[model samples]
Target: MSRLRSLSPATDEVLGEYEIAGPEAVLAAVARARAAASWWADQPRKGHLLRWKREIAGRSDELAELIAAETGKPRGDALLEIMLAVEHLDWAARHAAKILGRRRVGSGMLAADQGAALEYRPLGVVGVIGPWNYPVYTPLGSVSYALAAGNAVVFKPSEFTPGVGQWLADAWSAAVPSQPVLQVVLGAGETGAALATSGVDKVAFTGSAATARKVMAACARTLTPIVVEGGGKDAMIVAADADLDAAARAAVFGGFGNAGQTCAGVERVYCVRGVYDDFLARVTALTKEVTRDAYGPMTIPTQAEVVRSHIKDALSAGGRAVVGGAESIQEPFVSPVVLAEVPADSRAVTEETFGPVLVVNPVGDLDEAVRLANATSYGLAASIFSADQAAARAVARRLRTGAVSINGVLGFAGIPALPFGGVGDSGFGRIHGADGLREFSRAQSVTWRRFAAPIDLMRLDRNPSALERARKLFRLRHAR
Candidate 1:
């Protein structure tokens, strides 16, 4: 049997190999999930999986090591991602029923004699294509919510991190024990596409925008509904009155955390001209002191070339690297590089450079900062730093993104109540909280005819006088 090797990103060491799933095997997994979905949905209210959520939380250390070995991230970073995933899983289990339960609705005047209500029904099966960066957190965004909403999930983790994916599967059976509620399919992109077109009820994908289009096209064959969480060229704005030290720390984490391979990771910054020099000085000093050549490697091998090219493009177009230069993108690992005065149209600024790279520019004022921030095709996430809480919130609200943090970056993702997704090229649909629970369920409207109207308007033998009176009453009540 052919096997897929799970190699370490930093050392290129083979961690383990798993049997690769062909198209037939992929379909079989979905079939099994389809068969078990009804029983799983019938077991109890979907929210009863709270016990399973706890089980996942309990084994964090074991899973964290697997994450580090597979994805080449530091163990501490892997643990952090696992803890955050546990938080989201807990929230989903606790709130799914409230978010997806049926509720009564008011009937309009035309249907005054009718009683109306609505229900959110679970889709039988869901296909999830998860990304490699922050593997645990990204997959949990869809997997936890899908399970909470009463759907069985067939997860196709990134080929780079199949070991992490298998770890999740092991935890799933320990919690449930009776049914294969969550299944893992190991392979490359073909496996993911197979799941999408394999007659699943819905597909939730997280990855680059370029691949999102391909997933959409595959799902189109079966007309399966899909929710894509694509890449972003996220930005942060620093106001003149902002705390320089705090903003610098935020830039370091937002731009370089997880080897800068995050979907909502910060890639650019717009600073108020009054504090531009001070902010740059603080950022440069912090970047040099804290950044490391071995922080972590790019999970995907091909991403290093992309990062290197983006660096060269920026430097060749008159941008200056105040911190790391063009050679910063070493094989396997990409060192932190901060570019200054990069042109707006340069590929470094316009595209999603999934590396530890930051492009900071000076703006005349808050207006200019907001304008420059909104100038991207991506609307995934953003951050704003300012002394005035009111002013910072106001600017944060003005930027076009799915979520924004005041004086921080990526903070909204940790809060389970916020809807996480984006518009435009960043892709559409949502995950997390009430919106996510509803995303995996379908709405069903139920109405009952309580009684007949005063006049028999639908009868063929209706009297002219009664019809005239009904018209007059409707006109008097509605037209006035």
Candidate 2:
């Protein structure tokens, strides 16, 4: 058995240790969860939903503290996770009947005598491999919706934030009080792999694209369905007629919040040349005001090197740090840094640094800005700041991504009504709203005969004469 990995803040030198469940143990627990899922799913949907909400709400403070300690986020930010998650759970519960309930469908002419309907059924057991950053918000997007859709989930939390995962699992079970529909498997990559191949119904993974590929391959061995919410190099656009102050705040917070470990965090910015200088000054000032608290360390310690490399590459490529340059780093927490006049081909522009770094580039106009924003392999969430609603929505429609915010930043994720996920390399499948509910449930179609067939159309024992009679009747109706 592989030993459990230690967890530590990006700023702290000493590592805190926790024992990881071995692959065998993880599989055994998953098997038990699969067996228990049948009984859990049998419970009344409304009852289950009420219980989940009660659990989340009752222990709100404890959950918030656990989230903050595990991810090194501020208390307010941690509370945002709980708030957003609760909203999603509430919305999903209230709307699941409309989204997942059986609906009648028109049958084709050939089968008009039969009534057909479609419904969404839960997958047997879902494997969720969560990321360390935003341990509460990120994974809850998957776990909550999956549970609402009636699937049992075995969540493998990030090694750095196993305690948060355990807390959630324990709380959920406390509410349910009977079945362990939601279980936590604490381990590193190997345990995740075991879960992927553990004959599970499906896998919902959120992480780097490189790791997503590995997850896909592993699930393929078991022929299990999977949804990948891989990382993104998302971009933000500032139009000439946009709100400069709002755009600056959005950019700074979107880029540097959570120490910039967000998969959908703003990594690149494209601003119109007309307000480029003014926008740059405002953003630079905001960046100066933004400081990392010593308590808020790097959520993922290993990512420090990647952050350093991205900054070094940008500087080497002649990019100037208009606001924060090489002087930002102390140890673990990275001071928010803004890079300006960076080349489009630079690493910071093309790759996901997953750090508190932003690369701002000047564009000729709205057209050029849209082009620059859509120039990455990722099609995750994006932001467009413009006063022209028509123009903003038009540009947003053209961009290939899961969600887009017009005249606002990161507001799409806040809305519990809109679907959240990405296209292209950012990985497919949603984790919020209606899209999130559908992700965990498989579409099931059913048909019932309203009346007995006049002829033996479906009977394998039918003779050629019956087929000829049917053909003659069809030809007589449309011979003209």
Candidate 3:
């Protein structure tokens, strides 16, 4: 068996080594999950999930350290990610029954003598392919919801963060040792591909859109359903009436946090021309305060080069670096870089630069801002900052992204009730709230006859009068 090593992107220290799960191992894991699915689905999943949540919470610090070590995010940021993940777990556990339980359905007037009901049933097994950035939070967005909805999961975490994934699975095993309801399979893209086509009922993948296509293709052969949360080139818009200070602060944090590894992190900003100069000044000053060491090192080392290319391209296109320029990229770490006056068509504006960089451009008005924000093929998440609540909300409605934060940045991600995902190149399907619980399960509809119909419409021999009566009823109901 091939072994995979998890190393800290910051210090290059070996975090842990795991045996890579090949195609055979992935199939075995799927089989195990299939075996556990029925038993897990029948049990009181809330209790199991709560116990697992408690286990994670009890060792939150240890888990945070492991996350930091594996992902090169600051310890504090890792802790925050853990805390948010725990909150989502708790929410899913408490709300699953209410959301997925069988409920009476209204039978139409024509079927008044019948009783109908609907419920969501767990898929046999789910294969979750998680991303390296936000390894804990992003995967658990699917894992916690899937488990709460009573599906057994075989998770294949990103090779870069295998230790963190193993920790999560170990915590589950400790919490509920009766069955291996949740299992982690370690490896790189091949293992992920194996899991995708391993006959799991569904696959939940989070990563680049290009990689998502490969996962989709593998699952296509088996006709397995998949939910993809592809990364986004998200944006932020500042209106003329917006709070410059608040917007600038949010931009700095949203753009540079986690070294800009966040999929929904602010990559572009459109400022209304009236406040463009002041907003630019405020953003530049705040960005300057963010030193190279403020955030953790680039979790994925090669992403540094991508960041460099974007800055270089923007500069060559006549854009000015208001803050740290190309010099900000130091091997493992990239300091905050904010570019102003970048051309609308620059790769720095159009493509997703998954590093600590932001492109700021001036727009004539909020309408132009909205137009530019929606112009991108990606519609993941976005932010609109304005002091006027109605105006902000109106602008928010016009943005084509999946979720929008009004007067703030990324607030929707923290709210477990809100469904998260995107349209267009950002991918489809949601991973939280009611939609998430239902995403991992299939809906079953049932109808049973309560009493016989007076017309006896089922009999062909005596259907003449019944047909006339039915036609009368249909005309009365449909002739709006």
Kindly list the per-residue Cα lDDT of model 3 for residues 1-480, writing each as its tens digit.
899999989889887889999999999998899989989999998989999999999999999988988888888999999999999999999999999999999998888888999999999899999999999999999999999999999999999999989999999999999998999999998899899889999999999999999999999999999999888889899988899999999999999999999999899999999999999999988987888676789888789999999999999999999888999888898888999999988989999999999999999998898899988888999999988999888888888888999888889888998999999889999999999999999999999989997666666587787889988989999996
RMSD of 3: 0.9
C-alpha displacement of 61 in model 3, angstroms?
Answer: 0.7
Q: Candidate 1: what lDDT?
A: 0.89
Clashing residue pairs, backbone N/CA/C < 3 A, model 1: none
TM-score between candidate 1 and the true structure: 0.97
**Candidate 1 lDDT, tens digit per residue, 1-480?**
679999988888899999988899999999999988988887674444776776777888888898988877889988899888888988888888777788999998767888999988889999999999988999889999999899999999999899989888878887787778899999998889899899999999999888999999999999999998898999999999999999999998899888888889789999999999999999998888765544578888899999989989999999999989768766887788999999998889999998899899899999998988899899999999999999998997898999898998999888998889998889899999899999999999999988987766767999998889889989988899
Top candidate by lDDT: 3
TM-score of each: 0.97, 0.94, 0.99
What TM-score should be assigned to candidate 3? 0.99
Where does model 2 exceed 4 Å of error?
A: 1-17, 454-456, 460-480
* Tens-digit per-residue lDDT, 62-164, candidate 2: 8887777667788788888788878878887788778988899998666778999999988878989999887877888888888888888899999888888
**CA-lDDT, candidates in order:** 0.89, 0.84, 0.92
Q: Which is superior by TM-score, 1 or 2?
A: 1
Candidate achieving the largest TM-score: 3
Model 2 error, position 82 (Å) = 1.2
